[model samples]
Target: MIEHATHQKIALITGANKGIGRAAAEQLAALGMTVLIGARDPRRGEEAAAALRAAGGNAHQVTLDVTDQATARAAAQQIDERFGHLDVLINNAGITGSGQVSPEDAHDQVPSSVNLDMVRAVFETNVFGVIAVTNAMLPLLRRSPAPRIVNVSSAAGSLTIASDPDGPLTGLPTSAAYTPSKTALNALTVQYANELRKNGFLVNAADPGYVDTEINNHSGYLTVAQGAAALVRLATLGADGPTGGFFSEDGPVPW
Candidate 1:
């Protein structure tokens, strides 16, 4: 039987019911960490955890909603009561805020005419949600010997890439919601890393590199497993791993 002991490192991944988040949880579980599959939907969360358990991984479900402070706090409380500490926190929950906009149409996200509500909604999840969940779990994470936090960001959020005339996004319509939310997330990652570095926390942002998932209607070239590699790598980093930085599967990503 797989052991669910306090001696084992515990990882809590937000929105871990599916997509990159679920993929990260699976990878972490394979690495011998007690994985907590955090999902807003309890049913989905339990299904994911059961699947992992059936695969010989130690996994549990945590009813969590990044946007809801009550659920976030409740998840933290539940973790504290069960395991007493959390070794890793992967803030993988995010949204493109592209409701009804087809993947082909970038016009809805264009700066000038973009809906303000969409922008706010995107920030609420992609940016503010991270803060809510992280803060809620900070106490439990503090008790760990080594703590790690990985914020799933995107290449579109990279200012350097977006600003380059010859970059991949040169001719793409200017994004006002999804892209900006990721940028803000990256910035938040840095600030958190700075604040917690002295306390032995490794906080970094990861660019999953256009994985085929619900966010883009499966238009991405990469698979979920391929995209989750960066997050898993960062989450399992050694003591000397770089903090307050952005990375992809290949290497460092410029800010």
Candidate 2:
């Protein structure tokens, strides 16, 4: 494991303007890594970097919308030009579907009854969006000595837990979007990790157990900082760290 970013380990965290992404960026920057705050809102992104810098962290801002291919491409280009390479990428941007709709209650999500537009919007940010950014920035990531990709995911994406006959997630059994996107993200993690392993890049998905954030409408019990612990761990993993795996605060999570 060689996590000493003293060699200029530059990290980009999407959706870092706030919440768990913000927390991860803060911690990483505090560790002396050059943290790139990626956000759709430039004002918010700059503000976040300013706050981290005030706290003695080296931070910068980048205008990035993971779902927008143009923004993703340009961001990679800028990083390549300015930094010469990237050491880490955290795909932490995501969105949830409307109120929980159990699979059995599919009646509510009837192609006509529920909002199909909402479903598409959630997937755009949570699933496809992550893939878009990762692919776009891979050229920069490939240039690093120890590249790490951490997908900020959720336990809601665990099909084994969500589908078990008796499970804690049974409480959250429902979805028009969000969960499926994360499940898809978990799958994408494996595919990318498998491909990049030979390239010395580590890719893995992390479940930030029900963190209290704007994403969950602030209803969750864990703080954003607590949720970011697992993500930060994966982001800064040493060269020998695990890849193509799913993890949480407790430990490895079942697929």
Candidate 3:
């Protein structure tokens, strides 16, 4: 355990080596919080953290593979030993089982053809992983006066949007794997928020707005910063901020 001042807020973001996660980390660090770049690869995590430091931010690297319980526990332990408490936890690590989120790829993800193993793998990272990391970090988060947990979800997870005949989501293919995992994540976000609300822990889901990340094969229209905006906002929410809700930069998103 390393000794540090208790006044400083500490944040840990998973899958932060690149894309929206990295962007969110940089933005949060700019706000004066110590940001931990949690990545599955130690080298990449350290590289990202180094880049943040070079840019004048209080940043560090933590090797964290969200799907692995041991790594999640180790990350929590590291934070506990060094920061003593966690002010923010952003569950940004996720995957689209389909290689590319293209219209062609969408056809392969339809219920009948989608591989059950692929769906399980997607849920392992997006859903179960969130549970593992959040549970491991809860004790540290509870130490904060105003703890925040932001789960990075997607508009594709919204049942309202998916069910609408004239909605934007209606054009997309039915995704049995990626989409459902995010929907489950949204449910988890609400459950956690409801349970932790009395304790002043704000848990919410963030829709990153179809960013041009590797997950989408850089085909998305939004920029990384644009996608990260809602995430940073949720992570830095005040005590009076809404919890157990889904939101995007435009405002509240449907459940």
Candidate 4:
């Protein structure tokens, strides 16, 4: 059982073993928050925690698979027993069904030929997983004086951008599975924010920009730190910060 100073803010980041999630954890820890690295693999999670600790950050590992209900509940229970409260929750676990962003690879995701099973798989992790993890952690988050929930979303999730002829997403040959899943996540973010607004909970969705992460097969131009900036900003929002909005590093993203 790892323990942290009671006064330190505790943050849990899912899919934190690598990619943008890992970058967010490191940055949050640098701000003196006790970051809980949540990953499906215990070994990888422990290693990530160890890396953060070696860098003089207060970090711990929590075995969490966002798509698995049992794991989500168990992780919440562990956090509840250990910290008694949670200050920040960053739902960063997500997947791009095709595993790559190349046009050739994404060709299979076109509306006509796309597999419904693949779409379900994408939603399982990107949409339902966020709901599962958020519901499980709400109890702990509610105990915080200023609770913040950051849903790691994507620019592709914006219906306005997808429809705009001049938008970056307009001409991209993306899949229905990944893109729609993010759209659903963005919608979920708004609903959750609306429901929790009066409770002093700030729930917002963040578009991490195009980062060269495993999800994109390193096709994105932005670095992990660049991608994680908006998420970290949303997670550490002040009491007066805006909620129920979609934001990118540059600023507000069209719904």
Candidate 5:
């Protein structure tokens, strides 16, 4: 295996070619971590890595498609060959199940009339994909001195918030796809944290509040940097940081 600096932290972020994932990579890279930009498209991934390098950050590209286990395994093998171990994992790939439609026009996602196929697709990427990637990389992560896993979740996944009568999402249309997938992801995050805690792993879910990205067709009010803050914070948390919990920029998010 190729050797890297033993003291330097290495991070892999899926869907890091743009949006919140890329922003989180930028922050991590700025903090002196070698960031790996994981994208389904090789060209896009290379472009993003090159951009980060140009900006004076250590970056690399890894072809990753969370929905495909073959690609996940290949990514793991590649990382093992190059870095020998992985210090951080940011499972950030996700979908809104609305296609190219705007949030306000996502009537098709209404629980009563939502497409089962769309829901499955969303879960394939957001929930199951995380499991695939995490399991594949667990061996490499195990080699790190302080392994950290951060699952990029959303506030919509908070059942307590959605159920509140006067909550911020009170007026939003009922969702049956994207939102539920994130809820499942949140649960999965906690399970992983519980299972890996004895190994000194800091695993947590981050609720990146609404950000202007392709997921919502730029309808969100927050910037990408703002959306990525919670993720970066959790990935670099101290050993005393909370595990098996959901948090946002403000503080803990009710699950």
Candidate 6:
């Protein structure tokens, strides 16, 4: 087996100021990889990095706002200068546009009544942002001997589960905006993985299983650490690990 850090693998995790992203950063840092906590908020990013360092993890802050092309380029350039190569890229930053926009609103805020502008807003960050950040960082990632990219997706994005009236996801009706954005992300993951595989890069989508975080108002049963388990696992896969796959903690998730 290849030593986890012999090649000094460096990982960049977006929206890592808190929640599952933060947890993944800690786990990766514990394994000897230098973990970059990519945050839109610099202060929060620094605080998270400080907390991780205090906990004995090799962590640092990277000011990353996936929606902004300039920030994405700067971050990629910064990583290239410091680490020379990026071994893992975790697109963990995401938002539930409706929830963030109107907390008091009911689940009916989505579906037929979902504001199209809100849906577009979420897509800007969730879909287009991922593409921008990934493309900007692809150069450094390509330099890695075994590069890995993990898109933090959700079970809500599964068209199979979403369309299945008998499935568990049928309970959630408010999916027009946040959910479809993730569906697009899943599609993007497959295409990127197919294109990057010949270059020894493994790109896959990870379903964290609805962990309790600010996004869900702490109603989820799983903790952030538990939610991050699947992401961390997929992020650390070896050269021979599966690619172009969408997985959860239990195993593969349907498209």
Model 2 regions lying over 4 Å from their true place: 1-6, 99-113
Instruction: Give each model's whole-structure lDDT.
Output: 0.92, 0.86, 0.92, 0.91, 0.94, 0.90
Give the per-residue lDDT digits (tens) of candidate 2, residues 1-255. Answer: 333335688999999999999999988987889999999999999999999999999898999998799999999988877787889999998866554334543334334456676677778888889989999989888888999999987777889987886888765537656677788889999999999999999899999898899876798999888998999999888988999999997999998
Task: List the candidate numbers ranked by lDDT, top first.
Answer: 5, 3, 1, 4, 6, 2
Highest TM-score: give the candidate number.
5
Between which residue pairs do clashes occur in model 5? none
Query: Taking the tens digit of each residue's C-alpha lDDT, what string does model 3 give over 60-140?
Result: 999999999999999999898988899999999998887533444543789987877778889999999999999999999
lDDT, candidate 2, at 56: 94
**Candidate 1 off by > 4 Å:** 1-6, 100-107
- Candidate 4 residue lDDT tens string, 98-170: 7434445444788787877777878999999999999999999998989999999998999998988887876
| Model 6: ten consecutive residues of lowest lDDT | 100-109
Report the error of model 1 at residue 71, Å.
0.6
What lDDT is obtained when candidate 5 is compared to the true structure? 0.94
Candidate 2, RMSD to the unseen true structure: 4.4
TM-scores for all candidates: the values are 0.95, 0.91, 0.95, 0.94, 0.96, 0.94
Residue 245 accuracy (lDDT) in model 2:
98
Cα lDDT of model 6 by residue, 162-232, tens digit: 88988988666657888899999999999999998899989999999979998988999999999999999
TM-score of 4: 0.94
Per residue, candidate 5 scores C-alpha lDDT tens digits across 171-245 of 888889988998999999999999999999999999999899988879999999999999999999998999999
For 1-255, candidate 1 gives per-residue lDDT tens digits of 323354789999998999999999889999989999999999999999999999999999999888899999999988988888899999999988777344444348888888887788889899999999999999989988889999999999999999999999898878999999989999999999999999999999999998999888899999999999999999999999999999999999999
